[model samples]
Target: MNILVISGGPRKHGRTAIAARFIERTYGFHTVDLSIVDMPMYTGEEDQSSNPFVKSLRQSVLDADAVLLLSPEYHSAMSGALKNTLDFLSSTQFLYKSVGLIAMAGGGKGGINCLNNMRTVMRGVYANAIPRQLVLDPSVFDYDRDGLNREAAEQVDGLVEELKMYARIAKEVKEQQLI
Candidate 1:
């Protein structure tokens, strides 16, 4: 399955990216990182007239079978950049897609609020968001080269099993309707 991971931290070496990369590896699956680490900020209308950057970002979201958003808690929620990007991505880009969310914050609460807000947005557009969530506390892990964290790595395997199960059930239910 194709999975797109969006990391919402400005820092390239932060916990959110680390966890996302860990999940990315579990899939042996095709993936893209949508954080500031890669894509430029959204300018949906103007940039769309010429920019390959926005075009490619929109395509990636459309192609993925599942979306994984790894976000940090900013004043108890997701950062503006992440929110703005999604605001622009509503409709055909994100509609009816499966989504998985993970949030990590160093203090106060984890980014659960961020994920929930995102879930509401995704649901508004008819995306099938995965209900299981991962909330990371203290939000940082040691990455031994190659950006892989041991604990996060282990959890990804478990998450994949859930994704696979859901995919199977969804497929069966869909096929039954065709009969």
Candidate 2:
């Protein structure tokens, strides 16, 4: 499946980015680091007709069978970059697509809030968020070597499995509708 892994942290080499890289290496999923993307703050009045970055970002979502959103909790919520990227998308872009959320916090205390917030936002865009989510603590991830500990690796495995299953179901339903 064409899964898009979005690294939502602004730091190019943060824990979130590391985790996203793990996913990319393991599953060969396409990874987009928001730090490198030239996405401007959504003002709701910008001309997207000529914006190559926006167009490319939108097309990435359109091409993906599922999306894995990785974020670092910032003040009990997702990073502003993640939220802004979502703001650029609409229901049509996300409808029926599977969304898996992974959130990281320093003490493992704030990721739940970020996951919950992301769930709500995904719902608003008509995406199906898998029930399984990964709440990561940096200590559990070997950021120095860019790997996950045993426990974190298991959780990621489950999340990826769930996302693929849901994506398959969504694709089947879409195909059925075309018949």
Candidate 3:
């Protein structure tokens, strides 16, 4: 299925991206990392209707069957880049769309706040968000010659399973007649 995984963490290669990539690979789903999409902060002054970035991003979201929001906790919330990305899209962009949320953190809250906050935001946009998502503890890291820790390697399988299940069900139901 066409899946768009928006990475909400500032660090492009951080744990959140890694986890997202793992899930993408597991499902063999097509994903677009919004972190790499590159758009200036919304100013309202810019006509999103005409903005090429907004246009392309919106096109991708519209084309995708589901969206995977991978976020990190920032001030008890999801990252601003992510929030802004969603904000830029607004209700006009996401209505009737399916979304899945994933969050990660090094410690403490482990990004639950990020997940919850993004979920709330999704609600505001009238998105049909998937109920299941992955929350990863950074300690799962098994740092190797490449990077990350052993725990990261361990968590990969389970997280991938969750993503795959969601994708399968969503793809089937989305393709089938709604009951």
- Per TM-score, the best of the predicted structures is 2
Q: Per-residue lDDT for 1-179 in model 2, tens only?
A: 89999899999878888898888988899998998888888887769635787788788998999999999988888999999999989887899899999998876475999999899999999999999998888778886679888888888999999999999999999999999
Candidate 3 lDDT by residue in tens digits, 139-173: 66432432345555455445445655666776677
Rank candidates by lDDT, best first.
Answer: 2, 3, 1
* TM agreement with the true structure for every prediction: 0.79, 0.95, 0.77
Judged by whole-model lDDT over C-alpha atoms, candidate 3 comes out at 0.71
What would the per-residue lDDT of candidate 1 be over residues 1-179, giving only the tens digit for each residue? 66677776656677776766666665665544545434555666665535566667678888776777777878877766677667657668775577777777667775678778777877887777787777776534655654445665566566666666665566567679899
RMSD of each: 2.9, 1.2, 3.4
Q: What TM-score does structure 3 among the candidates reach?
A: 0.77
lDDT over C-alpha atoms for residue 146 of model 1: 40
Model 1 off-target regions past 4 Å?
35-50, 144-151, 171-179
Deviation from native of the Cα of residue 163 in model 1, angstroms: 2.4
Number of the top lDDT candidate: 2
Q: Candidate 2: lDDT over CA atoms?
A: 0.89
